[model samples]
Target: MIEKNHIVGKEAQKAYLIGVANRNTPYEKAKEYIEELAFLAETADIRTIRSYIQNLDRPNRATYIGSGKLIEIRTKAEEEGVSVLIFDDELSPMQLRNIEKETNLAVLDRSALILHIFDLHAQTAQARLQVELAQNQYMLPRLTRLWTHLERQRGGTGTRGGAGEKEIETDRRIIRDRIALLKKELEKITRQDEERRKNRGEFVRIALIGYTNVGKSTLMNALTKSDVLVENKLFATLDTTVRKMVIDFTPFLISDTVGFIRKLPHHLVECFKSTLAEAKESDIILHVVDVSHPQFLDQIKVVQDTLKDLKIENKREIIIFNKIDALSADERETLETAWLSKEDAPALFISALKRENIEGFRNMVVDTVRAKHAEKFPNQKLELYS
Candidate 1:
């Protein structure tokens, strides 16, 4: 329900990101979320001017921060000419309304920010439909904030006091209708896509997944030699791209799907279920992590939990620690030592951008795929290939 003229324009907004830390969520966790929020804002063409974190045992329940902190933030925002305030967590509709009213500025929460990024990144018709469904659902609950009050026309001063409310109701009905349509459309698309996957001739499918901007697409391209839209920005590739790949005379399919992040909106996850069906149906899951990121372990936990939620936990997995090129010599040794010593799924490090240590990745994938191939197609001759 963002205003078209203001939000969907070329002018990049100056935004202040705020996060609240409680005893349950320490300052470090809130700080990590704020950093991710800034990335989300950048994806939506917003420039974050600064970030503010308040250590409250709980949110203010009205402002999401204390009144004094809100006042301090307002003064700082005015001095910096910040146009909007982005919160690290989702705010209630009342909280959204109250904050905007007090600060006299627009407000976006982490969920809204992620949805906006998805809105920007969705390319194909299916992706667009999925994103629209999520957006409409998010808007439906916040209609009051979306449609502001307007008393009457200048010429007809006493014409209406509740016209704004009526308009909001009308908009809500329209959005609800649109959401219904979008659901049906997506179901049809999902069925069609399912048929296509079924007819793809029983190829081994590998799904690449990781936190956003951590070289998942780079690994996909490097492994399959296919062009995927890769960028340094968050959620750069929203639509799934599947490519047929061959290693050691055994052919399989690989897909690059949307990257995961901390605190992804639950509604978005539901809306993108059809898009994630590829991963759920895959034979192998490549959980790529950026070992270079300071909080890579936290990011890894987030992705693992997401996979479990998606019920993709049973797939044979490979933990790929990517972007060794960004690490110092000492850091690389330390990561390899730590990961290599662990008794878990096979772990390997590579700089996909630099094509480093990729041969090892291929050999493992080849072995994994070959084992599956042998188990499934034992009668098929592979003496020449192996």
Candidate 2:
């Protein structure tokens, strides 16, 4: 539902963000969501003019926000000359249409915004196919919003249907067909990927899993010595990148997969499951975390929940609390002590950007990979670096 052409050129599209705070989501949390939503807009190259949050018991079914609040927003947007309204939560087709009609501006929800980001980042054929499938699925139900320009034909004198109705039906069929074709193409690519993995010859596989913008790509680059695209944006690395490395003669494959985010669309998870197969098949998962974030713990839960949903929660994980350079000495010590006391999983605190504790990080990986490599190749003798 979000168009990118306006985002191009010198003047980026200006947008106002909307969020709802309810009994479940307090004002503070809703404010955080709005901030994240603004960041999402920024990543999509949209300039966030301002943000609005309504305190409601629940979101309005028709317009998402209260009528008064929406009116206020409309007036403010007009004063600011913002042409786009981005919602923190995904809206139903009816709600989206209502809000667009009432405000007379471009409307986008969290799901549509994330999908557009994925569409922009998708590079590999498989990644493109996966993103296309998710976009089609998301667009299928929201097709009515696309046909708002066409007037509905009256069924008075033997008319089949309105142009809008007929066009919607035709578009739905085309999207459905496109979805099916994308699925088939993805399955073929999945098979090819599986074959490639099988040919890797029993190397111990380690995959990096984490929340979006948590420095997973930077860490991957640090470890593998490969120049994978690293951007300071959410969902920067959509396609999985795997490289073979030898640490003290114990060779293994390490992969960097797409990062997890809060409120990620269900259709996206389903479509990208194939892309996440590397993590599913890995022997060890390096769950990277940005310790600098205020809600770092919540981000951990989000990743854990996503892993559980993917049925890979049982994998061996090492929680790497990254970006320690952003924390003070006292803060880092406090967090490390508290987290290590939990004794849930092996945790390491380091800064991938600053090359902090890098030797320790390498030693830990070498030890883990050596153990898994021993299991795979019992007859081979590998040297460990300490």
Candidate 3:
């Protein structure tokens, strides 16, 4: 159990972040990737004490990083009092076991870290079920490596073919059964949700899709004047929240769905497929980007690739470069010049937090919704400004 206090310790939740740079991935990009990983750790209340990068064509099969580098990291972790080690990439089962044996500290890969955050952020029963399913699926394969923790709990590892192994097998079966039950429960929940969506009766669905913590919820609140929980932490909103939003006296539906991240676990995505249907079913995608982030372009690509993976590449979209209030003068100007020139999908710059250009955003959304509405319901007359 990598508890928050375990991470924060008595004073701070210290951790070491590790990454790999290969022929395709340069050191500079790897550094940025580790910085994002550190941010994620901080979101989980862990402070990154250091960052390590191993420039290998591929990860070391046994340890992920070389044995010599592992020793250096272990020594450094001891010196720095870092309690946890976080890898930027997912570690194989063998790699995880080897690294834990070598370091003798809590090691978490990107998937586990993200799942932990999701577990923390899950509130509603549906969200809880979704996260539990993801966790169980993740745990099923990693159960073998948890013997040490089980032994620590029982105060002994027991004899060969003994209690630890039996307990692990038992836990795996329980997790498998629980995963099955959760899937059924999610099926029920999703049926109810789909019925609810269907009850809305052909409403033009516009969904806010973006990278995590990039003002999607804030923008949703700004647009709908309804608070749906906005936080700075990643994966703050786990449930798909839908609200009836009317602009220009034309009623439509808007969904603030779960945000995307780089290397989001396949298991989690599989679990949340129903939750993600809000985006897949949308008529317009308000692709929000945090223009303030230095790697905003990369974030955009991540969201795009995720959408492509979901096979939802044909939806009409509007680029919403949010948080412009935090951008530097030169960055803001260049972004505007570059994006504003594009004629395919309209791109608008605004700050959801600062409420800058919100009215313009409203007008743009109303116009877009009107156009979509006209296309869907050519004979219907919208009660505009009545």
**Residue 97 displacement (Å), model 2:** 1.3
Question: Residue by residue across 1-386, what tens digits does model 1's lDDT show?
Answer: 33332443557878999998888989998898788888788878889999999999889788888878778889998999887889988899989878877887778888878887887777899988888899889878887643343112112354343447777788789999999999999999999998998899756788899999899999988887888998989999999999887788878788899999887899999999888999999888889999888899999999999888888878888899999999999989988888778757788889999999999999988888888777766777655444
Return the clash pairs for model 2, or none. Answer: none
Q: Please provide, for model 2 over 1-386, each residue's C-alpha lDDT reduced to its tens digit, 9 standing for 90 to 100.
A: 22333333356878999998888999999999898888888998889988888888989999999988888888988998887889999899999889978987778899988988998888888888888899889888987643342112111232323346777798789889988888899999999989988888868889999999999989998887899888899899999999989877778889999999999999999999988999999999999999999999899999999999999966779999999999999999899889889777899999999999988999999999888778878876665422
- Overall local distance difference test of candidate 1: 0.83
Model 2 regions lying over 4 Å from their true place: 1-10, 146-163, 383-386
Model 2 lDDT, residue 181, Cα? 89
Which 10 consecutive residues of model 1 have the lowest summed lDDT? 146-155
Better of 1 and 3 by lDDT: 3
Q: lDDT values of the candidates?
A: 0.83, 0.85, 0.85
Candidate 3 residue-wise lDDT at 222:
89
Give lDDT: candidate 2, residue 370.
82
Residue pairs with backbone atoms closer than 3 Å in model 3 (clashes) = 7-13, 8-12, 8-13
